[model samples]
Target chain A: MPTIVVDVMPKPEILDPQGKAIAGALPRLGFTGFASVRQGRRFELTVDGEVTEDVLAQARKAAEELLSNPVIEDVVNVAVLTESAQNESQSA
Target chain B: MTAQNTELPLIGDYSTAGPVLTGARIGVVTFPGTLDDRDAARAVRLAGGEAVPLWHAEPDGAAALSSLDAVIIPGGFSYGDYLRAGAIARFAPLMDAIIAAAGGTAGNDAGLGGSAAGLPVLGICNGFQILTESHLLPGSMIKNESLKFLCQDQVLRVENNATAWTREFSAGEEITVPLKNQDGQYVADEKTLDRLEGEGLVTFRYVGGNPNGSRRDIAGITNAAGNVVGLMPHPEHAVEPGFGPDSAAGMRLGTDGLGIFTSVVASIAGGAQ
Candidate 1:
C-alpha cells in the first residue's frame, strides 16, 4: 500500500496565530533550535493497489479541489510515501 | 403644520392584487447540527413570505425545490465543525440542490424555471462558509484573530443595495445584528478582494471596524448577478425586538436584520407582478 500524503498550509502572507503561539511557547520550554514554526494540516491516505501515476493524479485533484482551499491555504505538497522509504528513513 | 390632504389620489386599488399576491415561498435548509433554521423560517414568515423546510438528509429535496421562489442557508455548527466549520456541510445532498438552483439558472437537475436573478439564495454564517467551500461564493473563514469564540451584536453597513437580499436597504445604511461564531475571519487573495470592491459585489461591511479581522472589513458579499448572498452575521437573530440586540438609543428595538428577509420577499413579489 502506498501512503498519499497531502500537506496544507496557510499562505505565506496570511497570519498563523496558532503557529505563532506555538513558536513563542517553544523557547520558554527550552527548545531553542527552531527559528520559526508554521503549523499546517497533514492528511495521510492509504490507497490500496499499486501506486501508479494515475493514482497520483487523482490524489492531486482531490487535494486541489476538496482537501485544500485556495482562498487562505495552499496545498504545499502531495507526494506518495512508500513503506520501504518509511522504513529506510526510520532506520537512518 | 398645515392641514394635510387626507384624500391623496389612490391610483388603481392596492387591494386589487391582494388575491394575486401569494406569499413567496422561501425554502430554508436544515443540515445536521444546524442551529438557526427555525429562526430563518420565522424570519421568512414574519416578512410576509412562506417558509418551506428542506432537509439535507432527504435526498429528494431537489424535486420540491422547484416550487420555491428563493432559498436560505442558515448558520450553525454543521457536522459539529468537523474538518473545519463548513467543509462537511458543503457536501450535503441538499447543498447540491441549492448549488444547482442558485444564480437563477437551473443546473441539470434543478427543474426550476425563469431567471431568478432578483433573488435566489442567501447564506448566513456557517452557511456562508459552506458557500465558499462549495465554490458557490469566494473567500474562506479561519479562526478569529484572538482565537476566541465571539458572541455580540455587530453593526454592519449596507455597502451595496443591488443585491437580492439587500434591496430594501439604502446604500450606506447601518444595521445592527447578532454575530456569534468561533471561525469567522474572512480571507481571500488580493485580486479577489479588489475585484469584489471594483464590481460592487460587497453587500455589507462592518460599520465601526473589522469585527473578526475579515479582509477589507467585509461582512457580506453577493455574486456577480447579485442574486446569491453570503454573510457572516446572524441577521435572523435580530429580526424581532425585545429578544434581539439593543438599539443605539438604549432601547430593545433591533429589527434591522428584518430588511434582509423582507428584501427577498419584496423582490420575489415584484418579479411575480
Candidate 2:
C-alpha cells in the first residue's frame, strides 16, 4: 500500500491562539530556546494500491476542496510514500 | 384553548403591511449539531411564511432545495467545528447545491455570481462561516480576540437597508440581538474589505462596542445582488419579545431581530406583486 499525507496549517499572518497558549506554558514548565510554536493538522491516507501521479493530484484537490480552508489555512504539503520507501523507513 | 395550542401574541409584526403575504416556503437547514434550526423555522412562520426543514445528511440536493423562496442556514457547531469553524460542513451535499444555486461552480472564480442570483439566502453565525468557506461570501472568521467564547445581547446598527434581510430596518437603525460564539472574529484581505465597503454591502455593524474585534466592526454583510446575507448574531433568538435579548431600555422587549425574517418575506412578497 502507498501512504498519502496532507498537512494543513494556519496562514502565517493569522493568529494561532492554541499554539500561543502552549508556547506560553513552555517557559513555566522549564522548557527554553524555542523561538515559537504553531499548530496544524495532518491527515494520512492509505491507498490499497500503488499511488500514481493521478492519485497525488487528486489528493491535493481533495485537500484544497475539503480537508483545509483556503481563507485561513494552507494545505502546505501533500506527499505520497511509496511502499518500498515506507518499508525502508520502517526497517531503518 | 389548550395551553400548548394557545396563540400568544408575543411576536409583533415587523413588516409593513402590503398585500397579504402567505405560503412563501423558507427552508432552514439543520446539520448534525445545529442548535438554532427550530428557532429559524419558527421565525419564518412568525413572518407568515412556511418553513421547510432541510437536513444536512440528505443527499438529494435538487429535491431538498427545489421549492425554497429563501433559505436560512441557522447557527450551530456543525461537524463539531472540526479543522476550522465552518470548514467541514461547507462540503455537505446541501451546501454544494446552495453553492450551485448561488451561481458558484466547482472551479475558481465560480462564487462571483450564479444561477441563484435572485434567491434569498441568509446565514447566521456558523452558517455565516460556512458561507465564507463556500466562497458564497467574502472574508473568514477566526477565534475571538479575547480568546474566549463570548455570549451576550449585542446591539447592532442597520447599515444597509437594501438587502433582503434588512429591508425592514432604516439606515442607522439599532437592533438588539443575542450573539454567542468563540470563532467569531471576522477578517479578510484589505481589498475585499474595501470592496465590501465601496459597494455598500455591509448590512450591519456593531454598536456600543466591538464584541469580537471583527474587522471594521462588521456584524453582517450582503452579496452584490442583496439576496445572500451572512451575520454573526442570532436573529432567530430575538424574534419573540418575551424570550429575547434586552432592548436599549434595559427591558426584555427587543424583537428587533424579527425584522430579518420578516424583511425577507416582505421582499419576496413585494417582488411577487
How many clashing pairs per prediction, in order? 0, 2
Error of 2 at B21 (Å): 6.0
lDDT of 1 by residue, B1-273 (tens): 112213222111122122323569888877778889888987887787888767676567567677888989889888898877888888776776677767433343445333344338899999999988877788889888777789998999999998779999999999999989888998888999999999998899988777788889989998998788999999998887777889975566799999999999988987832
- Please give the lDDT score at residue B268 for candidate 2: 81
Leading candidate by lDDT: 2
lDDT of 1 at A26: 97
DockQ of each: 0.49, 0.53
The TM-score of predicted model 1 comes to 0.86
* Candidate with the greatest DockQ versus the true structure: 2
lDDT per residue (tens digit) for residues A1-92 in model 1? 67898999988988876888788899999999987888899988788988789999998998887787777788999999977877896799
Model 1 docking category: acceptable
- The global C-alpha lDDT for each of the candidates, from Candidate 1 onward, is 0.81, 0.83
Q: Model 2, residue B140: what's the lDDT? A: 93
